[model samples]
Target: MKRFPNQIIRLIIPFVIIIAGLLIAKKFLVPASFGKLGHFRADALGEAMSKPIHYVGQQACADCHDEIVKKKAASYHKGVACEVCHGPGSAHVDSPTENKPPAPRDRGFCPVCHSYNPSRPTGFPQIVTVTHNPGKACISCHNAHDPVPPHAPEQCGACHGDIARTKMASPHVDVPCTVCHETPTEHRMNPRMYVPTIPANREFCGKCHAKDAQSAKEIPRIDMGTHGERYVCWECHYPHLPQVYNGAAK
Candidate 1:
């Protein structure tokens, strides 16, 4: 019995000593630096990890960021709250220590409400068609802080350099790129802006080719008629402007 008690004491003494050492080390270690030892304070960690907290319910966010709430009001998304598209964010805000906020996946977040049907203009390219990756999120290019699409097609050229260069070489280069490409709220150009109300018709081509239009008026110009559905004004008119418009019918 005496030997058994000594053996137990030896075992417990090591454990007690280890615990005391931990306590002493904790006293010396700063709370902020405790992460170095793999110890994180829930409150501090929560604040540190707070990265705009995906969809933390617009209401809760509005409570703090009323300015954003006011700006977003009366916008297309006003009917929808932060959680409608972002999913549940309360758990993340409340217990972010254990729960990690969902990744900012655009396709996944949008499809929850938007559909491919024509009724939903936002889904035109369809989440799947535009972004092959379902995990892709819309906010990647869009800033929720300033929900309005502030970037124009010129800005889009940053990521779409090839398209931008190609467009620069096209006859339509004179037109501001945004005239054709629009944002979430306005995607398609209004057809009426074209003279013929048809983008491919001769009248549509006359809008900018004022000189050609005047010459054609006096010369009874050739009725290209969209080149028998084979080519449009772009095919004949060099997009590089005066340097490219050689005055040749072809």
Candidate 2:
């Protein structure tokens, strides 16, 4: 081959040197175990395993809190693990004397999970905290372990004894007051001036009285097209003691 020109030789020498330098640097710079486990540092697994465990699980918690676990098991909140509210118990489990788990309070505890999110499943109870109870803790009315508050009728009756009596004697005795009125979680916490809305429309009645509903067969069903269009349901029948009357005279 013809001898390379001085300028060309100089350029080629620098390029070869740069490639050799990169190869040498890569040998020292790249981790030895990197790619040994397919793009992950093999030593990282050992590092992670060496770190202390944080969560000890619900079974570990139940060893000392069997009573609480028992109540939780029977309640709607049975699926919620103890550590979800209580935080990680590994430290506490490791040394019960020194590492005590903090007690969960009402500040932002319950609403963290219970607060109204439209994306939550339909059966999950959710509340708009601001509208429900402005400044009250959830524990005031609801049991922390069993969670489900007292029956609506009894709770409503505790304050509205007269209305409760009237409702108990009415045709709608079996129906819950919450059916027509909404008592948000906040209202249950502090019932100061909370006046539940009494819906006075035919469509409200149509929820249970609509002839189209398959489940409403056991209850009175009406044709809203013909029967209840002219007047509100309460216009003809009393809300507490609904009774069918002849003609629109009432």
Candidate 3:
């Protein structure tokens, strides 16, 4: 550059001034301990330590609640810490007799962890709290300390809960579960080993739906010969909801 052009010099001047201003401001504005060891202020460690510790950890709970703690450890809730639901235990630790940690007993409280959400990790137990055993507290059936079935499932809904909920609102609500799936008594003890039988052919459904079938007159009738020939009824219609199993029909 033989000589600095006025237009170029004007742009350079503002940038230089701004850079100098930022450098000068940083020295005064930033904490003295900032970036001492890393990006964090060195004084931040002391600030956090000054705050009071609330949780005494799980071992602290075993002193008084040994039986319940052992039960929870052996159950599905082994990984869950006690304070996660019960809140901070510092108050109770100082006066164990007087300050009993309040327990969550309401139906709404359990849903915070157990309610159905797609974002939650797969295989995690979830329920549609609105339709799942409505009007009953979760603790009524499930012991909070050791949550497992009290006995073998007496109702199909105990395991096939989603299907049960659908059938509740469907036209087949009055239909018995045994009518569709021929479940054996042994299936209750070992469901995997002793499986239930599904309808093999359309004739099974025709027992209820055929026009001339000896069944309730109020039940909808279909011509088994013409309607859904060759394919089984369940291929198109879900027995529980009594609608198209796949893509929407209505």
What TM-score, to 2 decimals, does candidate 1 have?
Answer: 0.30
Candidate 1 residue lDDT tens string, 1-250: 3456778989999999999999998787747555653666646666768765445557676765588678777554566666654468777667655865554454455555544566765322333435444444667765554444444333646544676777787654656655544434233222222222225454555554444565434432445544434666556544334234356633
lDDT for 90 in candidate 2 is 92
Backbone clash count for every predicted candidate, in the order shown = 6, 1, 0
Pairs that collide, model 1: 105-137, 106-136, 106-137, 106-138, 107-136, 171-239
Tens-digit lDDT track of model 3 for 63-143: 989998999998867878899878899889889989989888889888998999999975466889989899999999898
Instruction: Please rank every candidate by lDDT, starting with the best.
Output: 3, 2, 1
**Runs in model 1 lying further than 4 Å from the true structure:** 1-61, 74-76, 86-107, 119-126, 129-135, 144-250
Predicted model with the maximum TM-score: 3
Error of 1 at 214 (Å): 5.5
Tens-place lDDT per residue, model 2, 1-250, is 9998999989999999999999999899988888998888889999999998999788887888899988999886888888888789898888898988887876588888889898986435677888876688787878888887566423867656788898898779998989899876556544543556788677788888888865645787778899858888777777877765668323
On lDDT, who's better, 1 or 2?
Answer: 2
Which is the better candidate, 1 or 3, if ranked by lDDT?
3
Candidate 2's TM-score reads: 0.48
TM-score of each prediction: 0.30, 0.48, 0.56
Report lDDT (Cα) of residue 216, candidate 2: 43
